[model samples]
Target: MKTMPVLNTIKKRLSAFALGVVDLVVRFKRTTEKMFLPWDKWVKPEGSIAREKLFSRFPRYLKEPAGSVRCGEGWYPLVWDLCTAIEAMEHLGMPRIGHFKAEERLGGLFVRVESGSFIVKELARDAEHRAAAICEECGEPGSLQLGHGFAKTLCQLHAAQRKPHKVKTVPIPENLATQRPKLLFLDTEFTDFDYPQLISIALVAESGESYYAELENGWSREGCSAFVVEKVLPQLTGGEFFQESGYAARRLREWLAGFGVPIRVVTDAPGYDWVLMLDLLHHELPPNLYPTPLNFYSESLPELRPLLKQAHDDACRDLSPHHALQDAEALREAWEVMKEHLHPAILRQYLKL
Candidate 1:
């Protein structure tokens, strides 16, 4: 007893319609719930600050019908991080904060939690250190700004009245008046698992000049991690600029010569990138070019880690990460933050700028 073909099709369409109606109802309910929540806007985007000032009165943690928590005393940028930490504490178990204040002298955020778990206490301490690195005003990347012989974490813009900030000035070297040690940050996406067969390459200079090209027959590696699939794949949409490996190699060599002398290349993954680049370039890099990792100068510069982290935090990223140029720009940004601390002559010599 087979049903008519038209009757079966009608039944399938009805089922689809029923499911669509149910889905709409579910979505509408969720949208209504979010609309009523007072603090929904804060955490949606990571860096955007939620609140500027804390409530002066009681019920800091608003109850049902208007669920929200207030920070005791943190301003822009750092306030975002502070609220994030408090939200984490709420999930771990709401540890009621009895007193909260900014400790400028200590470079910390002090939150006295009266109840709940020990993790709240730890988070309180964590927030304090983070606050020290972030400016309480603008969210821009800044260090602990000190003025009038007093220390406060703030960006240069907000801390305008602070004690004279030192900036190292270096003159162009006499012998190589026109040439500077331009940073060429190189990063690659490759084909091989154990041995890197080159797939794509990006070279970013300090001036924001970038040369990016992918091999026409670049072998697409299988079994890549989820990160590569989700993040890297979408960005690598092919372009007409992409060329055969051999032609691209010679063009790259000619471009290198255009810079005149001494190209300092930085690679985070030194071993893999060096091997892949050498293979792509046919033999080895030119005599004037030297590639080293961020760790190369780490021993002499013990302060680089914190400086780098702070620089990274403060930067408003202009380019997408994983692409070679953006990663290089990041490295340059970190070094720029630390330049004033370096002797002017040494800085010029080191960066060739």
Candidate 2:
């Protein structure tokens, strides 16, 4: 019986060794690491054995498409490395790529897959290191190099292109042409009066598309107004922002992207809330992707919310004031009523552009 058990163990070891030898043979035959595996789902790396161990570890791969990060179209070549890792993770039983993105940092990329399995974690960790070896510009073979003061992972071609190019800042045009602005009215609920810390924010576009999110962490009903505690707190509890500090912010940015730039945004508390909103998104968005920061024209549009609220209160139907989307809708309603009474040109004077 003992001999039989020992023989079975030897047989398993031999089988594993034979499979490893076959993987080696397959790799030896391949010309490029970028080539797809026999199963079209995988794009194996040059010297990586990670793919070989995938299926056995996680057996339930999601058939649905895992999403890709928007690192601009220029970096598409380098993106394939992580995409392949994402696919391998999928085959190993995680369906969705949680987040694969290039951070504001100079080198390497971030890989986050949803499965949270040990093998998937290993794959992501390995990909993070391998990214530095891939060319940042052309996606060819590359290595981290220091030329002047800064270091970047770039090929010889791109490195040459990085050679000091003349950059000029264009001055503001003498005659400024203006486009008829599309205004999305926005509102925010926040903690306290002194600092007016942000809690929940919401916006409704002229097109009826609306977004609302509560900043999840480092916030409380304490030190906030009773009206805010009563009105905003209940609505904020289940919001996606509470899921992550930045989730709601990203969703808002995505919603804004739907409306094209020179995005003229209006808020009730521009002095306080508007600044708070920008502060909330400072880390979440890049400079190029940053939405036009808006301020409430406190001088001209002072008491704008109160006037709108009073008008709303006089109406047959009343909207609960101070809730973000409701308040934005109130602004929309008030604007419609105000425009009917006065010309839009005059209204723009009050809006302060």
Candidate 3:
């Protein structure tokens, strides 16, 4: 019995040594594989390993032989685990994956797999749901952020580096300046879209004359939206231009009266800009100003829409946006670039000239 106990102890030691050797060999194989791989294929600039292993391990799923990974590196491990689980389903006699594609869509992971069971779809969805809380760039905890007309998933650190989408500048045509029917491009910065109370108003005439004013009272800061508070309020310069609502209205009327010619107000947002202007004027618009504001929108002239946007972007680059005066100037620039493309019939309908 004593000899048998000693023999059993020796056997246990040998088994432990064998397992250790196996683990060392596995680690060495991975290290050697990385050593032999191309420099670019081994690591990315962001410090994440390249997706070559994923492709090589699941060649049947990833059809693309060579290309950058479709999603962020933070989600790489999740993707690898998902793929492993999917391949394991083969033991259950599940159908083979005919096609597999994964990408980021609207700040979330989206995976499409052709020829799979309900369980496969559930797996993909679960992965996506989990990805919403995982930073796409560094795999840290993250959330979906929406701004500048796009959405992205990022952690606080990575989100700070994201910039708003830039609007491309469109050069104004050399001979496309309008000389007829005085146009006043208007813009207003208000408290909120739901119940907007004018914070400031501006009008830029085609002849270079302009009017701007900030309301000193009647609007509460509590009613302001996050966008208005951040982008609009900070741009305000409250000096001589700041006045009471009644005084501001009188100033605006007097300014409109100075323009002896019939003037048409042009604005991109008629519902907000035009309504706020009318409210400021106390429903008694100047005789020289047109009763109906001219709607400047993509639907008004589809062909000139891109040119108008480009011109506005160009103006915004020169002057800060969100300020009523600056926005009005931008609107005027957009009108000047796009007016030449307007049909005479459409012009007559709006200008009545």
Candidate 4:
């Protein structure tokens, strides 16, 4: 009879231990689900909790009768819940869930993971797309507010600060003691893979004066290399403004002369066009006119990488049917957009800026 009591006591203790192990396993599975699922899926589209939803808190994990559990410190639990709920709404394609760390999308704020579906993904993508989209190259929440100007997105810093763009007919300011020479906007057209050749050139002057220089059959390799020699030999060369009957060569030289003093020679691709001008005309353009750009290619500037996608999309929108002048204008517009968030004054001092 004493032996029977001992056996009974051991059986009861073993049953209790088995129940404890099962409880622990259940709690761990719940925590894992809470940490990974789309938090918003549990809620309605408007972000209000559904009537069918119920939550009960325990010492370790929150128990849900449905299929998942939620737990974490701060607003994390709530965020996780919202994300999970949103994912459920979107056919159970869960978001990539985790605590917020470094981000260029939300201005690095701690954003709760919601759904990572098409809609939410696109929004997130836009946030980090435009690397050089800001003047100072900042993003996410609490950073510069993005504003639109001339159909371009400007961050808080650069928006509404510049003088309105002047029309071609607008005259110079009357207060000028010295006459400012008119600037000419010039752009060249060439195929993507074309090496050394002249296709077409569009020259637009400040007074809205414009012209095109089209070669009879375009320049060949030898013709492009020694253009002034081979091409010029076959045509009449020099006068005041009408120098050389070959309209392209003479007009280019006249345009170059306008840079007697410091001036801004705006172009879409300064690296390429500027190089061509130097090679063809054999003249060194003034340095001040060509400000070094903050391109994504620069290893020193990493902030711009985060914004490239947005910048490219914006450029594409404004440059649907690509042309030399259109691309140039698009680039100029991009600069304006970037300047809105990143003030040139502050950005100039830092290498990364």
Per-model RMSD to reference:
23.9, 14.5, 20.6, 25.3
For model 3, the local distance difference test gives: 0.72
List candidate 4 segments past 4 Å from native.
1-187, 192-194, 201-246, 259-261, 264-271, 284-299, 305-309, 346-353
lDDT of 4 by residue, 214-301 (tens): 4443232232324334433233211332222255555666655554543334344445454444444444434323323223223455
Query: Model 1 over residues 1-353: C-alpha lDDT tens digits?
Result: 45788888976676556445434543454455457744444223345433432221112533322334332133334433444445444544565554444333433345444445444445445556666666654555557643222344567764552222222223434444456556776677754343234667877776777777777653433423345557665667477657898888887777766777767666556556655666567655565554333232444445555765666556426557765545556666666676756688866554434
- lDDT (CA) for every model shown? 0.53, 0.54, 0.72, 0.38
Off by over 4 Å in 1: 1-180, 191-195, 291-297, 316-318, 345-353
Score every model by TM-score.
0.43, 0.44, 0.47, 0.32
- Report the lDDT tens digits of candidate 2 across residue range 1-353: 59999999986676556445433543443334335445433443333233223332223331223333422222343344444444544544565645443431444556556655554455555556666776655557677655322355667765544333222223323222154456677787776554355777777776678777767563444436676667667765463445455766677667766665445566546655566666567535432222443343335556554655555555315767666667777766765665566667767776443
Task: Please report the candidate that would top lDDT against the real structure.
Answer: 3
Backbone-clash count (model 2):
0
Screening candidate 3 with a backbone cut-off below 3 angstroms (N, C-alpha, C), the clashing residue pairs are none
Better of 1 and 4 by TM-score: 1
Q: Weakest 10 consecutive residues, lDDT, candidate 1?
A: 161-170
Q: lDDT at 140 for candidate 4?
A: 17
**How does candidate 4 score on lDDT?**
0.38
Error of 3 at 84 (Å): 81
In candidate 1, clashing pairs total 3
Give Cα distance to truth, residue 170, candidate 2, Å: 17
Name model 2 segments beyond 4 Å from true. Answer: 1-177, 223-227, 235-241, 283-298, 301-309, 312-317, 351-353
The RMSD (Cα, Å) of candidate 2 is 14.5
